[model samples]
Target: MGGSPAHLDSPMVDGYGKLQTNGLRFHKRLTKNPCLLDCAQTKEYMLHVFRDCWRARTIWERLVDQDKWVGFSQGSSENWFLRNLEADFNSQGVTRWRLLFGVTVWQLLRRRIDRCFNTEVFGRDPVGVILDYVLEVELAFLNNKNLGRDST
Candidate 1:
């Protein structure tokens, strides 16, 4: 939404399988539940982590609150993930949503790692930390684009 869509080559972007399953296994080995965030009620799978986890759900709801076109909880969680991936490229918010979606997944995955391997580094507020990181990266991206244009 902010810049011409550029290809993201990292596994974090193109490797849905890796992101989803790795977190599942990593957290599973740690807590016997695949969920990155422990809600203490039920075992978490990929969909729950991204869509139903109270923390993640709140983040997504806030992200799309003003947009009428999309709501994260409107339909099947699996369908939601698949549809967003294949959404019409020309749609107004699809690009932006895709970017945000990827960032959220990446951050969630990172949080999972920290929770398991570096407990001291995992913050008390994971959604907040993730949002801060995403915003910081977005700002850097915008600044780099501006510098490129100025140089050209």
Candidate 2:
């Protein structure tokens, strides 16, 4: 019950202004450009990078239900996270919806880093690949929990 906020901030655009150090004076020296996607120049906000960007959109479309996607993608980052953390029993029909949510966003950020800073490496469809990995981990965690409970 302690994960009130996750470090899902995007230092590139949204978090740039939140910095208070004297560094803020020369913050312009930092890279102030497109989002992690690099090509997505319109909005460099954290919301766009993690949820609304085309790259994130494709993955969320596959991972989230069409009925909830609209609301899920809307809201201040803090509210979006608070709701996800306090949400009911299951999201993707799994007991740990918040875990699934966290992992998906983490993977999205990792992917963004990979695509921008490192070499992109995924099979035919990268989105599908990431989705599969996230779901697989969710199931693995459930299985591990079941195994622990069974032995107890």
Candidate 3:
């Protein structure tokens, strides 16, 4: 995860896909269902969590334009992460698509883990939560710009 942007999304030692497979593993949480939403009886694997999950799709919908949704959502999962990370825009013309994408993935996984541990907050909105995290990180990065931080 240190040298590659794609490595930042391996779902290893992280509450991303395999770890949040409806509690089938990762210490086996409260439920062993197919999905945290409990609406799909399918295994919550990496691709599912990244692109197919209903909740994840919702987050993508809010971020991606309808015209580009198909391209952004479909295809081999291997190219999915890399293409998105290399993208220069995030539908809204935001040049920081990579940052937004990374933060959103992290927040999605974080929310999944949180739901597994805290059922009381199951109604949480992932899109809003993820964007908030993205905004915070973006702001911090912007603040550090021209401040000798990127000189490394």
Candidate 4:
């Protein structure tokens, strides 16, 4: 019953955390700005990075109804995933469709951060990002399955 949080272990978490942390540090070093350090340190926390951040809020709103995704507002990321994902997995099955949803969330978060921090882009296109990640994950799963079979 215990495993990493579905959304937390996603590629987006590692990629986004690295980008945010490094961007924070780079901003601090280049500008000699203490305010950048403050923003970076504050953003390192998960709730602030994922739930409360303005960019993340926009993505979350688009992908899920407020009532569905708002559990994270009350609890830790682990709690949110465990409670909600379990319900989703039960209903949807543990197939790629269910797992990819989690991956989509993670990827969208990373895309949102990239669009905001690395580019002049301001809009949050969560649906497009989610679709892209879902297709990528699905392709990876299929490739892995194909590789596992015998050549004969």
Candidate 5:
């Protein structure tokens, strides 16, 4: 059941795989580490890349703890977002804020991969990028909602 296209093509799964592959390849080439070049994929590595990576941890902590936008369970990105959407909807944040959170998290993951893989320097701060993305998305959502209100 979890192997369906809905699961396979999820942004979280795709993003995680892409980031993990890019990160592994970049580190191997940069450091000339043969061990990394042959490293097998694992769930632990994917979790580390998505959640515990030094760059990404701060954003996860802030969103889950400070903002209360997410829960505490460690799971795939798709599961996490789906669970959070339900919780947020039940909590009455469903209209716009929930969508903003979901989209921002997805964007943050992609941005992290882009910054890491596309830059001349290898190390990029995922947490900082996540924060910036969250703010940008939130502002856009608010602006759009306000425009709708004014038009109505």
Candidate 6:
């Protein structure tokens, strides 16, 4: 139940926080910018990208179903993220969930960047691209954490 919010160090989360508050240097706001996401459900917005985007929702769904962590699917504000970080769960579970949250945000932003600059990396199914990134992040996290723990 006690862990630092170190997972929030992700650059994507920082940029997304800025995006939500009109602090980023985007050429246009969500109201004016073209929604370049594969979902293309609507104009791009912070809440939409993190909480309501169809593709984002899909990722959350998979996390909930597979990891049994339902908290990721909740809340819509920047404050919601802070609350999630402060949520009461067992220490190891809390760390894992926080890491998952950060990884999810990072992958979401990476997907958008890939669409903008490296369309071929996205291939046809963008959801698949996201799933692959999530798997890689989770595996890397497990390896890193295991390396840090003493076997004795």
Top-lDDT structure, candidate number: 3
Q: What digit string (tens of lDDT, one per residue) describes model 5 on residues 42-114? A: 3235445455555445555555544453454456866765666675422223345565456545755565545
Candidate 3 residue-wise lDDT, 9-118, digit = tens? 54443444334366464345445554446445445677677778887888888888778777788777788888988764366554588877887787777766666666
- Writing each residue's lDDT as its tens digit, candidate 6 over 30-136 gives 22345444664545567676667776776666554444355545666777678656653222333355656666677776665555545456445544554565567
Candidate with better TM-score, 2 vs 5: 2
TM-scores of the models, in the order given: 0.54, 0.63, 0.71, 0.51, 0.47, 0.53
By TM-score, highest first, what's the ranking? 3, 2, 1, 6, 4, 5
Q: Supply candidate 5's per-residue lDDT for 10.
A: 39
Encode model 1's per-residue lDDT on 13-118: one tens digit a residue. Answer: 3333334344445544534555444576445566766677776666665555444435445567678777766553222233355666677776765665555555
Model 5 collision count: 0
Write the residue-wise lDDT of candidate 2 on 75-102 in tens digits.
8977877887876423356456676677
The per-residue C-alpha lDDT of model 1 at residue 144 equals 99
Q: Across residues 49-101, which tens digit of lDDT does each residue of candidate 4 receive?
A: 55556655565556554455544345776775565565442222224535644
Report, for all candidates in order, the number of backbone clashes: 0, 0, 0, 0, 0, 0
- List the pairs of residues colliding in candidate 6: none
Better of 1 and 4 by TM-score: 1
Q: Each model's C-alpha lDDT?
A: 0.57, 0.61, 0.68, 0.53, 0.51, 0.56
- lDDT assessment of candidate 1: 0.57
Candidate of highest TM-score: 3
RMSD of 3: 5.6
Off by over 4 Å in 1: 1-37, 40-42, 66-70, 76-78, 85-95
